[model samples]
Target: MDVKQVSVADKARRWIFSVHFCTPIIIIISPRLQILILAFLAASVSACKMNRCYNESELSEAVERKLRSHYHQPPDPLPAADPDSPSSCPVELYQYLAPHEENRRSLSPWRYVLRSMKDHFPSTYSEAECLCSGCILIQDVPGKGRVPVENFSYTSVPIIQSRVFLRRDLCGDGGKYRLTPVSQDVAVGCTCARPMST
Candidate 1:
């Protein structure tokens, strides 16, 4: 078996020259000065590591924190209405806003579209319930015997939509998270309307 021996000076020279901070000036400088410069560079590299990017788990936790800060909760349910008697349309306030609003309400899209193609993104979420959960309509079908059938009826129509931005600085200094534009449906008020299809 052949053995290779490396001396302390050789090891020190290899380490010092291997560093990226080494330059032509390093050769002209004194050994003591070179050691000091290398030490400073080592300290700087370690300092940068202190601000290392967040890992998967840490990033998830950070995103959750941002979401919790801007969490939007639905309003309390309205009192139950009489089943047999016709009830007026019910609505409640619903809002989801960012820490700082961008006031880009006009950017919201009316119908479904690709979020990436949207020019304006949501920074604030402000919306309201336009209609009830579900509506059923009874219709009479022509047959030998008159038979009544129930069909799903009403739906909440969006009058306006606001493009809003989700959490920003998701990763911030350490890391970054992709921001996808979101469209929020906004209904100013409630109304009685028929489905275009049904």
Candidate 2:
């Protein structure tokens, strides 16, 4: 066999051995090539580690920051009722009742009643007053049952308005009361009569 051909065969044998041994036989045969391969492997390993390091919290925070930069305020919190109040109504109730004359037609009767009460009545009321008169307007219609507005209890009271608008009645039995009336935009106002202060 030619000497050059013998050299080529020897190189092929080494390459095959390297593959079986799980080593880079071709790169190891040349010092310059080995250095280039090592550099590429190091870069690829670093990239892989970097990609794996990112987590969901980091991604979420990044997205939130981007949103804040675009809009002057952070996203609104989920609607929730007052923590101190008796009612567990979600904050969505207030959002839905917000004064929007154009959207009045879209509101349901219950919503209208709530809006009217918030707009018309005083901020606070005693339990007796609310049960008898405060929530009296919320009658049990054909489909709807008696809408209770008594006490700060969750059972009777459907919604809790802002506490700042409410004051405890000292004259009578001494109970909490809300003064704000429901929104005028609603057609059917609350049926409850105004509480007369002693």
Candidate 3:
């Protein structure tokens, strides 16, 4: 594209870049605009610090350690994190700000949007339960499973949903499998584990 073909979007980009080199324009702007700018800055800063929610390395290590302790043997040194795994879970900034939140009251409005999108799109997870024995991780039998739809008009359907909870495993025997059907409440999920791997 030639410079003569520059569109309004390009012009706006040029204007923004040119003004960014200037002094704090928010100071000269109206109070509402200044508050908006400050709120944005605060949100950005808060997002950068959201990793304090829970250290995955530490938490995963702890879970693994728990598994080892249950096995009645001193476990070896921690294994390296799966290098092929996806990036860590992204959480809102407010969840960790308070030491003891009652019922997810601190979440901002955007979290709802994120959650809705997550549900509507695609996801994979394993349900688990903590009984007197140990944590039981129950997952679907591996397949490219798809949802059966009665309505032909609806094109989008969920894929890979396990109808039976037959696969059961004690949490830390490196995916110890009992292969007995069961039910569970808590679901541990991520976009990383492959359909076959889980």
Candidate 4:
């Protein structure tokens, strides 16, 4: 195969451009796949650098940066069923940390993996659901360092339709509890990510 020399700038530009273009295709296919793609993109993008690894702490911080930029809010304290309920799902920033403190290999830039779970408590309860699959990735400008490139991913799991009967105690304990409200839709939004390289 014939090889053509490409400048670093040209290569970086091509990669960033390609990732941006492929995202819509991946998203169009399905949401679950989107999560995976998102993870792949960030990880791959991070790897593109000469030094392709950061520590868990660095990765975690990058995750925060990406999330904060995306949601326009802190990544922690992610939305819960009951915003005020103390028993709500703990605001876990990173569910799974890399085995090593530092990145041995390409880290999962999509480090914020919020798996689906039911938060059941006696007084208050909440839930976080995954809604989609696949993902996206972005690379930094060839030579910039001030911005600290950002990388992250959000995964959405399919929501199964089911009948949910909500009981409300208007009186008191053991008193009349109304189970009139029913729900057939489940909205699950999950995210996973790691960090970005400068």
TM-score per model over all chains? 0.24, 0.18, 0.19, 0.22
Mind giving the per-residue lDDT tens digits that candidate 1 earns over 1-101? 22223345444432223223444322233457868999999999966643345554565565444345544433322332233434322211112324232
Over 21-81, each residue of candidate 2 has an lDDT whose tens digit, in order, gives 5544432344456578799999999665433322334544533443354323322222322
Show the lowest summed lDDT stretch of 10 residues, model 3.
Answer: 108-117
lDDT of 1 at 181: 28
- lDDT to native, each model: 0.38, 0.31, 0.28, 0.33
Residue pairs with backbone overlap in model 1: 108-162, 108-163, 121-164, 122-163, 122-164, 122-165, 123-164, 123-165, 171-175
Per-candidate Cα RMSD to the true structure, in Å, reads 17.9, 21.6, 23.7, 27.7
Candidate order (TM-score): 1, 4, 3, 2
Worst 10 residues of 2 by lDDT: 127-136
Query: How accurate locally is residue 126 in candidate 4, as Cα lDDT from 0 to 100?
Result: 32
lDDT of 4 by residue, 39-119 (tens): 999988865641223343454454344334432321232334333333312122223434552211122221122233222
Tell me how candidate 1 scores on lDDT.
0.38
1-198: candidate 3 lDDT, tens digit per residue: 112222353343221122334453321233466578899999999665422222334444433343344322222222222333333112223234354431122111111111111211012222211111111122243582332112222121112223222232333445332222333232222112122322
Where does candidate 4 stray beyond 4 Å? Answer: 1-123, 129-136, 144-163, 169-175, 184-186, 191-198
Q: What lDDT score is found at residue 115 in candidate 1? A: 20
TM-score attained by model 2: 0.18
